[model samples]
Target: MASRRTISSEKGFIEKGDATAFSPAALEKSNIAPAVPPGVIFKLLAFTFAMVVFPIGSYFATVNTIFRGKMSNSTFAGATAAFIANVVLIGYVIVAMKEDQSERLEAEEEAKKSK
Candidate 1:
């Protein structure tokens, strides 16, 4: 006697022992590309850097000079840092919106050209 292993298909049948059908080498041949734009990635990294560096830099820079290093003035330095963070966030938002708008306009132009 012999064992039989099979899988049904739309056209006919497939053997269950066909390991090559789902092999890593086969999967690696995919033609898919990254969905994100490189510019978007760069912008995200830039904003992240700004978010970290600007706030801390502002706090330290102002704590001694603008705020006189007093314990009470430390609060002002903190506030300034928070404000800089907010500004960076707003700038990121504005940049993303502008990029989206530009992409949308380009798509519309392409559609018009196609028609």
Candidate 2:
């Protein structure tokens, strides 16, 4: 069974241990937020290309001398592809981030004008 206790009126009915989160002052603060979800696919693809593919391809490309290395034509081609893919993904992410930022700024400005 759950225990129930009456809160004293002097303390604004806030329960113990809820002082920080349920406080009235905390409820008034807000911020302009990002439009995109945290797990958006463009962001995932960009991060994967930048963090995973780029480094592995770079390692294969530099493991030995360029002219006499064990790296074959296929390996070189794969490396080139990885680098290009990362570049494209990174560019798309940059554009997306900028657009989100602009939208957030505009929203904030409009909100301020209303008040």
Candidate 3:
């Protein structure tokens, strides 16, 4: 069973601890704005490549000392760094995409009223 409650305040009407998520308006209204999504296989491929392959390959290259700048370079250290970097990059992309619509269409009513 669930409980129902009403919230009346001077500010506005809202529910307390509702399943509804952070009630936020469009990003354009705020200082932050969303970026456009990529299109086509090439864009996706490139995105995933940057997200996945490069880090893995870099890890191997770093760990094996496959290519090192100097004798002091530690293969293990390089590999660890590559792995961490790859994870960070992937997370960054996911967060960026989840933000919001880069562009929003004007409400039909609002447009009509303007004319």
For model 1, what is the C-alpha lDDT against the true structure?
A: 0.90
Each candidate's clash count? 0, 0, 0
Ranking by lDDT: 1, 2, 3
Tens digits of per-residue lDDT, candidate 2, 14-99, equal 43456777666777764457676665767767676666766666655654435244447557656765776677677767877997
Instruction: Report lDDT (CA) for all predictions.
Output: 0.90, 0.67, 0.58
Tell me the tens digit of each residue's lDDT in model 3 across 29-93: 56543363444345556666666666666666675565466565576656576777667677767
Question: Sorted by TM-score, highest first, which candidate order results?
Answer: 1, 2, 3
Q: Which 10 consecutive residues of model 1 have the lowest summed lDDT? A: 7-16
Please give me the total number of clashing residue pairs in predicted model 3: 0
User: Estimated TM-score per prediction?
Assistant: 0.75, 0.38, 0.32
Best by TM-score: 1
For model 3 the local lDDT of residue 113 reads: 84
The candidate 3 region of ten consecutive residues with least summed lDDT is 10-19
How much does candidate 3 score in TM-score? 0.32
The list of candidate 2 runs beyond 4 A from truth reads 1-71
